[model samples]
Target: MQFSIYSKPSRKKAWLLSALAIALLGSCGKAPVQNQKPATEVKKAAEKPAPAQAEAQTGKVVVYQLFTRLFGNSNNTNQPWGTIEQNGVGKFNDINEAALKGIKELGASYVWYTGILHHAVIRDYSAYGISHDDPDVVKGRAGSPYAVKDYYSVNPDLAVDPAKRLEEFQALINRTHAQGLKVIIDIVPNHVARHYQSLHKPEGIEDFGANDDTSVEYKRDNNFYYVVGQPFQVPKPQNGYQPLGGEAHPLSDGKFEETPAKWTGNGSRLAQPDFNDWYETVKVNYGVKPDGSYDFDSLPADYATKSVQQHAAFWQGKDVPNSWLKFRDITFYWLDKGVDGFRFDMAEMVPVEFWSFLNSSIKTKNPNAFLLAEVYNPALYRDYIRLGKMDYLYDKVEMYDSLKLVMQGTGSTDAIASVQQGMADIEHHMLHFLENHDEQRIAAPEFAGDANKAKPAMVVSALISSSPTMLYFGQEVGESGTLDSGFGDPSRTTIFDYAGVPAHQNWLNDGKFDGGKLTEEQKQLREFYVKLMTLSATEAVFNGAYQELHTVNKTTQGYTDKTYAFTRFNDTTKVIVASNFASTATSFALTLPADLLQQWQLSGGDVELKDMLSERKASLKVTGDTASVQIDLAPLESVVLKF
Candidate 1:
C-alpha cells in the first residue's frame, strides 16, 4: 500500500516555536507546555482512566550495550593491528562514576559490558603466568571475545592492573550498580578458545575436557566432541590472509599442536576446518550424540509452560551433560561477584534443553536476572522462549531487518506491521536493537550512510512494544564503523582489534564523559536518542497494548508507504507514534480508527495531541465514525503524540 503526504510549510513554524519553548522550559526543569484550552473544551471529551492492567506488567527494559574495551579508549591512534601499547586500551577504571552516570542519564537500565571476559589475545601476559595464545588460532591482535579463554576471570587488557583484572571488573560492576544500572557480560556457552585452559578455576573444579575420554568421537559426559586418531591441523591461510598481517611471532608458524582434534565452534567436525569456520574455538559438547540423538534425559511436554523454579526442579537429581553443570557453576560464580545478567553468544548453536537447565538455574539464584540470547532463527523463537526459559531473544530476523530495509529505502513500512502482528504472542520476549557489535553501523556507507536516517527507525524500535530496547555504544552520536582496524572488514565496528572508535572518542572528549566535542547535528541526534530511550524505560504506555495505524491509513489521502503509524496505550496514558522514512518533508493525516476511539471512550470532538519528543502540537478531530490528526514530519522525523 502506498501513502503520500502534501507539503505544509506553515506547520513548520509552529513546530519550531513549540520546540524552542520546550527546550527553554526543559533547561529550567519544568513541565512541558500544556494545551491551552477553555475549561468547557477540556471537559467536553474527558473519559475515565483505563484500568492499570498494563502497569501490572513488567517494566520496560532498556539496555545500553557498551563495548568495554572501546568505551573509554581516548587514544585516537587507530593503527592497523596495533598492539595494546601502541593503540592503548580502555581500562575498567575508565568506566568511572562519571562515565556510568552519563550512561544512566542516557536511560540505560542495564549496561552490557561486552568483551569483559578473559578471551584469547595475542598479547603476552607471561609475567602473570598466563599462557600465550598462538597467533594462528587467534582471529586478531586482540582476539575475538567469543573465544573465551577463561570463564572465571575478566579480560586483562581492560584492567589498570593486569594482576588485579577481576578485581577491577568487579569495581566497574559496583560503579555501574551505583549509578542505578545493572551489569551484563558475555557468556559464550557454545564454545571456548581452541587452547582452553582455566588457570583461575575455583577449588575442586577441574577444567573443561579435563576428565574426558578422548579416544571416542562422542561421550555422554565428555566436555568436547572429539575426532579421535586425527591430530588437529590448523586451517591453511587462504585469500592471501595471514595471522596478524603475516607479522613475525614465535607462535605464528601456522601450527598448533593437538593430538586429537575437537569439533570447531560452528559445529564443523573436520579436523582441518576451513579458514571461514570458527577455527579459533572448539565447540562445547552438551550430550547430543554425533547422530543428533540426545544422550541425556529430555524435559516432558508440559515442561514448556513450566516456571523457572519448576524447570530447575525438573533437572534436580537428573543426569545432565557435564558441560551443562560446568557452565552453571561458572555462571553462578559470576553471580556471586554481583553480575546482574548475561548475553549468551550464539545461543542457538547449543541445544535448547541445555538452556532450559542453565537459564532456570540462573533464575533460581536471581529471579530478576536478565537472560538475553542471540538466537537468529525465527522458527526456534518460541521454543527458546518457552522451553529454554530465555528472558529475551534478539528480534533481528523480523523487526531489525524490516526497519533496516525501510531505512535503506528498499522496503515498505508495511512489513513492520506484518512483523509485529506475526510476533504478537511473544513480542515482549523479543529484544530490539538498531546497532550492535555484529551489525553494520547505521552511518556506514554500506548501510544508510547517514546517522540521521536512523532517527525515525530508532523511535519505532524503542517505543514499539514492551520488549527491551538496546543502543550500542557510540550509536547515539553515530560511530560510522568505517575504520579498517584489521582482521574484520569495515562497516562493522571492529570487535577483533585494538582500535579507537573516533566518533565515540569525540563524545568521550578526553574522559569528560560528556559530548563536549560533538558537532551540533551529532548532539541533536544524541538528544533524540536520550529522550526516546528515557521514555521507553520510564513510560508505562510503552508496555501497553499496541494497534497499527499503517494498514488502516493506507487508503487515506496524503498517507504513503514511506510513513508508518501506530499507537501504544494502557489504562491511563495513550500515545500515537508516526515515522517518516522519506527524504523530504511530508504532511499526512494520522488517523486513529473508530474502534480505537471507542476503546478510548472518546466522543466526536477536537482532541489535542502533543508530540512527546519535540513538544509539537496537533489537533485530533473526531467526527462520527472518523478521527484523524494532521501531522507534519520532516525527512526521517518521528513523533510520539500523547493525547
Candidate 2:
C-alpha cells in the first residue's frame, strides 16, 4: 500500500515530539538494565568463536554531493533575485585543500561536484567571448544546471578569472585527487540548452545541430529534432511570474528567436510548449525517428550478460549517430582531464542503446570510473545496469520513497523489509540517499519538520545493503530548504538561483572549514554522521550478507510496527542494527532468526553486544534456536550493535 506524502502530525505535536527527541538524543545509545550484564560475564561469553564466511570483503562507497556554486559561499544576504555581486557566488578556488580535507574526514570516497558545467545563466559574459543568454528562456538568475549550454566548457561564474575557468576546474580536480578522493561531475546526455554553443570545441568538431538539415523534421545523423515549419514561441508567463522577479533587463522582453523550433527537453513536440514544460532546453536526437522507430543498431540479445569490454568491442568498427559520437567525445574530454566519472541527469529519458555505447567507451578509458544515472522506473533498473553498463542507479522509487513514508509517520517499518527483499538480486547496484537537489530536506516543515527525525531512516538507508550511500552537502547539519530563493520554491535546496546554505555556512565557518559556529545539536548531528559514514565506507560487514529481523520479531515482546531490526555479517565482523521510527521511547526484544544464527554458528549462550556509536553495552541471550536482546530505543534512535 502507498502512503500519503502529505500526511503529517499536527505542528504543535510535531514540535513537542521533536523537542523530546532532541533532549533524549544523548541517551539513544544507552544500554537497558535488563541487557546490561557484568563486564566480566559478557566478555567471557563473547569469547566463544563464531564461524566466518570464506568470501573476501568488498569495500562500500560513500558519496558526498556538493553544490559547487553554493558550498563555499559564505554570504547570508538572501535577497530574492539578487545579483551575483549581491548574493555572492563561490568560485572554484574557494574549494581549497582545507575544504577537500574536511570532506575526506566525512569518509566520502567520491565528491559529486554539481553545476560545474557551462549552463545558460542570465548573467552576461560577452567580454569573455561568450554569447549572452536571454532572460526569457533561463529558469532563474543563475539558470538550471541541467540546461547545459556548452559541453566542452566549465561555468565561467565558478572561476576567479572567467578566462581561465577550465584551468581552475582542473586545479580543483587535482586538489580533490590529492586528498585521496575521486571527483564526479554532471554529463547531461538527454538534452541541452536551447541556445547551445561550443566556442572552445576542439578543431574540426562541429556544435550540435550544426550539420543538421533543419528543413526536415528528422534525420538519422541530425543532433536534434525539428518542428518543421513552426518557429519557436516562448511560453507565456504564468501565476504573475516574470524574469528576474519583474526587474527590467535588455533580454527580459519575453522574446527568444529560434527559427524552425526544436522539440523541448521533455520531448514536447509543440513549438509553443506549455508553461510547465522544460522550455529552456531542447531534446537531443539519438537516431530515434519521429515515428518512434530506432534508426541505430540495437544491442545483441546476449549482450546483457557480457562485460563492458565486450560491449565496447561490439561497436568498435560500427558507425554511430552524430549525437552519440558527440557525447562520447565530450565524456572522453573530461576523463582525459582527470575527472573520475559522471552523474547522468534523467538518463531513462535517453535510450538504453546510447548508454551502452557511451558507458562502454568510458569504461574502456577508466575501468574504475563511477557512472551513476537517474532512472526512476523500477522495471528499467536491471536493464539500465545490465544492458546499459551503468555502475549505479538512484534507488528513489523503492528505498527512498518507502523510507520517506516511514519517516513522515504515514507508513510502517514492515514495508522497508519487503522493499529490501524484492531488490536483493541487484541491491549492490542501487545508490541510497535521503536528500538531493531535487527533493525536500528532511528538516523542512513540509517534510518531517525536524532533522532528528531522520536519524533512524538514515541508518537503514546507509547500512541496509551493499549499495553506496550519498549525503547532500548540508544534510549533516540539517539545512532545511525553506528559503524562498528566486525562481525556486521552498522545501528543496535551490538549483536554479544564487543562494547561500545557512546551515552549511555554519560548518564552513568563514573559510576556516570548521564547525566553530555550529550549535551543540548540530555538532552532535554531524558527529553521528561522521561515525556512521565512516563505518559505512570502512567496515567489511556493510559489504557482506544482510538478513532482515523485522519480520521475525513481529510477535516478540514490545516489538511494534514503528521499530525495525536487521543484521549484516561477513568473514570477520557481525552487526545487529535496531531503529525506532516513533517520536517516543520504545522497548523491544530484538530477535535473531534461527537461520542467521546457524550461519554464524552460535548454537546457544550469552553474547556481548557493544554499541558501535556509543559506550553502551548489552548482553544477548541465545537459548537453543532462539536468540534475542532487550533493546531500549529513544525517539528516532538507531543503534549498531557489534558482537
Candidate 3:
C-alpha cells in the first residue's frame, strides 16, 4: 500500500515525474485486464463445487496524507459545498469528484486528511517554520486546519458543509475501497486547539505563569507511573508553567499569541500549555532558548498532569462527563472511524497507561488495529518492545547512521546491525520509512542538479529495509525537499499531486499549477513501487525480520561501500536482499554459503532478478569465481535483487 513520496519543483529530467512508471516500461502489468472466458462452462464444468477457500492474508494499510489547501482539482467547480477558494486558488464545489480522482490516481490504501476541523478564530497558522504562502504550503480560504476551534465542525475550506463532511469522507473511503485502498485521518490527542470550548471564556479561567505547575518534581523519575512496575515517569515543566482550567477563550479581538498558551522568553525551560488559542496570539512553547544557542526539536513535549486518581477528591466526588474526561475515548473515536491503526503523535508525551488502556480497549473493537509510536532512539525502543506492551517507534538513529555511511561511500553490516538485532522479537510491530511528515525530505534541494540518481538509491533502501513501511506524502512519487533546520516550505509539499493531475494532460490547457508535469517521472516509479509492494506483501521475508550477510570483496569501491545485502529468515521463509548504491557496476565473489548453494538458481543473466522496483530486470551475472552485476548506480542509483 505504500505509495510514492516524491513531490516538488525539483525534478530529475523532463521525465522526472514519470520516474515510477518504470514498472510499465517495456513490460506488461499484472493482468491489467483478465481474459474473458467463454459463456458456456467447458473446462471442468461437470465437477461439483469444492469446499470454500480460506481467506487470504490481511492487506497492508495504505495511508495518503492530503494537504487540502493545495488540491487544485477544478473539475468540482459546480458540485456541492458552494465554491471554496483554497488559498485563493480555483474553488472546489464538490468533494466526491476529488475523492474519486484521488483513488484512481494514487492507488492508495487509505486517504488521510492532515487537518480538516474548523476553528472559530484563527490568527497564527504557522507550523514548523512554514506558512500557507510557501510554494508547497496551501493558504486556504480559512486558515491552517491544525488550529481547531471546533472539533465537531469540519473546515468549510476543506469540505463546504460542516454537516456534510462525514458523508463525503465516507464516500472517499468507499472510493478508496473501490481502488483497493483504505482511509485514515489525523487525530490530535495531546492538547486541544487553544480556542477549545473550555478556552472560549478565558476571562473566567485561572492563568498561571507559562510552564508553571504544582507538579512535584520527583528524583530522576519523579512522575506518576502509568503501570505498576514500570520506571517510566512523566516530564514536568521546568519553568513552573501550570495548565489552564475551566473556561475557554472569548471571541478573538486580536491574534493567537496573546491567548493563554503564550510564553515569554522570560524564563528558560518554560512549557506552554496550549499549542495555540483561537482568540489572541499565544506562543506555543517549543524548545528553550539555551545558554548560548537554541535547540530545535522535531517532536515537542509538554508537562504531564497529575493522574486522575491522585486528585481523587477533585473528580472522584464530583461528576464529570466520561466522554470528555476519559482518555480512552480518543481510541474509541478512531475505532469508530474504521481506522486500521494509529501512528501516535509524539507518543512519549502520552503516558504508557494511555497506551495500555488503549491497547486493551482497541482489541475489543477490532483485534487487528495496530499502533505505531514516533520516537527515534534505540534504547527506548528496547524498553517499549521488551515490556511487550507498546508497538513500534521510530528508528532514526539506525536510518541516519546507515544513510551517513551510504553517502560517505562506506557501509558495513555493523552499521545497521544493532537495530536489526533489536527488532528480533517485535518485527511485526516495527514501522519503517525513508522519510516522514515531521522530518525533512530525503532528497534535499541539493538534488535540483540530479534527482535522477538520488531517487533510485533512496527508493531501494526504503523498500528493502526491515519494517512495516510508512511513507510521508510525496516520497514514492518523488517529492524532493530537505528542510531540517527550519519548518519546511508551506507550498513546497505535494499534497495535491494526485488524481487531478493526469499523466497526459496538455500543459498548455491545464496551466502549470495543475501539476500535470509533476507526475511524469514519479508515475513510473509509483507503478514500479506498486509491483514491489505487492511482491513484498506476498513475500514473507521483506515484511518480516532481516539480517545482513557480509561479503569480503576488496577490489571495487561499491563492492563493499556500494553494496547492501540482507537476509531475512523465519521458520517458514528465507529472503536475501542485496543492493548496490554505486552509480557504476560492481562484482561480488560468487561464493554461496552452504544454505544458498543447496538451492538451484541461475547465475547472473541466467538468473533474472525480478526487482520489485518497477518489476524490471536488474542486470546481473554469475561468472567463474565472481558474480558480476552491472547496476545503474550512475549516482544515487540502487537495486534490490532477491535470490
Candidate 4:
C-alpha cells in the first residue's frame, strides 16, 4: 500500500540519506549469530510459553496486522527516509514471547505478519548471494512489500542470517501457534515484483517465467502477458519522480531490458507505463484471453453449494493453466510449513476460476484455513465466497467507508442498517477494520483526526456482525500515521521506509513489550481497545443474530443521526451496543422495539443491565411492549450493555 499524499520531500530526503548512510556502514555479509547458544536453544527461547495462553478459538477471528519490520523497532530517531541502521529494522527474532503475549492479551486470534514474503528492495544483499535490485525498478528506500520477488522465501532483511531466513520465519509461525494464535501472510496473486526471481525455490519447481516462449503476446500456458516484438521501456519520471531521489547508481539509467515486454501489474499493456502505474510489478496471467474470454472451463452453477471436497473433486480431471498450478504449489509449500491462512492481495483481479481451484485445494488440506481476500466489488461478493470458495472479503467500500462518514459527523447511522440489510446473506463472509496498512490512520489529520473519535466506529466495526475484526499494530496505542517518510505521505504508516513509529515505540518500551511508557490517556485508549477486542473474541453473541436498533430509534425524542445502536444475542447471552459520535457528552434513552423485547422474552418489568466495558450497572425499564434504558455517554464513547 502506497501513502504519498502528505509528504514534505525536501525534509524527507535528508532523513532518507541518513538512513541509507547508516545502512551502508554495515558489511555485506552474514550477520553475526544473534545468540551464542545453538540453533535449537534459540528456537526454544522464541517458543517460550506465555504465562497466559490466548483464549480458545472462538466464533470471531480477531486479526492483528503487524508490519513485521516495524513492530519491534525501538529507535525514536524517526528521521523520515532513514536507513535500516538509522531507523533500526525489527527482525523476526525480535518478535519474542513477550511481544506475542502482548498481542494475545489484546485478544488476536490471528496475527497477520505483513511484509514476510521476499520482496524487491534497494537494500544491498550481494554478500548473501542475493542480487541487489536496481532503484530504477524499486519503489522506495525499502520497496513495497506487495511487489513480491520470491514466493518460496522470506525477506532476507528480517533474518539474522540471510541464508536462514526461512528458518527464522518458521520459528515465528511456531511461536504464533503456541500462543493459540494462527498466522496469516500476504499472497499477491495478481502480480509480482518487476524483477521476480526465486533463487531458493524447491527442487523441480520452475520459476514463474521459466520455459515460457517469450515471442507470443498471449498463450494458454504462459505465466505472463507479454507485448510481443516490443521491448520494455522505463516510463520517464513524471511528477518530479527520481530513481532513489536522483542518487547515482551503476544501474540507475532508467532502463530495464525485457524483450516482449510484460503487461504492468495494473494491466497497463503499454511498453512505457505511466509513473503512477503499478510499474514496480508485472501482472500474472491466469488463462484469460485478450478478449476477456476464459481459456479454461467455468465452474458449474451447482458448485456454489457444494462442499470444498466436491469443489476439489471437480478440478481433479481438468488440465488447469500453468499460473494456476504455480500458485497452488506456492500455497501448499506454506501450508506444509504451518501457515494457517492467507490474506490475498488484489484477489479480484485474477479470475474467479483460479480461486476455485486454489481455495478448494487449500481447504482439502486444512478445512479451517482462513482465506480472506481483498475484494471491494460488492456485486461479486457472493460469487467469490460461494463459488470461488473464499472465507472472507473486505467490507471496505461500504461498511468501512460508511463508518468513516459517521465518525466524521457527516453521515447518519441509518445507513448502517441498510448496509447490514444488504449483506444479510453474506454478513459472516465480510471482514471489518477501522485501520489497516492501506487506510489513513484514525488519529491522522486526514481521517478522524483524533484517536478517541474511533471508539464509536470501532464498536460498530467489531460488534455489528459476525464478521472478523482486524487491528493494525499500534492502533490501540493511537499511533498516528503522520510521519513524512520518503516515497510515502503522512496519514498512513510508512510501509516503504525504515522508520520508527513514535507512539508504538512507547508501547514497545525498548523491547520490553509493556505499556510502562504510555501516557495516562494513551493507556486508557489501549484499555478501551483491549475491552473491545476481548469481548469480540470471547462473546458468543458476537457470533449470533444481529439486529440494528438505530433504525427504530431514529425518530425517538433525543436520538440523533450520529448515534448508532445494535443488539446481538444467542440462546443464553444478550448484548446491547451503543455509540455516540458527537463532540460533547450526550444522554439518550435507548429504546428496544417490541420485536426485540419479545425476542428476549421480556414482558413489562425492570431488568438490571451491566456495562461490559466499564462494569457499571443501570436498569432498563420495560413498559407496554418496549424496553427503555437511560444512558449518559461521553463524546466518542461506546458502551456494551449485557443483560
The C-alpha lDDT values of all candidates are: 0.82, 0.83, 0.38, 0.82
- On lDDT, the leading prediction is 2
Model 1 segments more than 4 A misplaced: 1-59
How do all models score by TM-score? Answer: 0.91, 0.91, 0.59, 0.92
* Clashes found in each candidate (C-alpha, N, C closer than 3 A): 7, 0, 81, 5
* TM-score pick, better of 2 and 3: 2
lDDT of 1 by residue, 1-643 (tens): 0000111212322332332110111111112233221112111101221211112224578899988898899999999889888898888999887788778777788889999889999998999989999998998898888899998788899998898887777777767776777888999998889988787777667788899999999987799988899988998777788888878999999899987999988777899998767788988888777766666666666888889999987777676767888888888878777778899987777777888889998998889899999876677789889989999999987899899999999999999999999999999999999999888899999899999999989988888888999999999998899998878778888888899999988889989988899988889888888888878888888989999999989988777898999999999998999999999988888777889999999888898989999988989999987898999889899889997
Total backbone collisions, model 3: 81
Lowest lDDT sum, 10 consecutive residues, model 1, at 1-10
Q: Model 3, 1-643: lDDT tens per residue? A: 1111232222211222232211111211121122221122212111222221222433233345544443434342221111233123222233344343433344344455555444322223333221222111111113334434344334444444433544444444444444444444544433333333322112222221222331322111111101122221112322332111111224221222222122211111223322111111111222112121112111112111332223222222222212222234444544554445555543443333334334545555565555566544354454444321455565555654465456445554345545555566655556555555444444455422223433433444444454555555545555554221111232233222112212212221243332355456766655555554555445555555454554433344445655655555555544445555555665553233433423434333345555545355654455533454444433443445554
TM-score of 4: 0.92
Which whole-number lDDT from 0 to 100 does residue 358 have in model 3?
45
Off by over 4 Å in 4: 3-55
TM-score order, best first, reads 4, 2, 1, 3
Comparing 1 with 3 on lDDT, the higher-scoring candidate is: 1
Which predicted model would earn the best TM-score?
4
Which ranges in model 2 have alpha carbons more than 4 Å from their true place? 1-58
308: Cα error in model 2, Å: 0.8
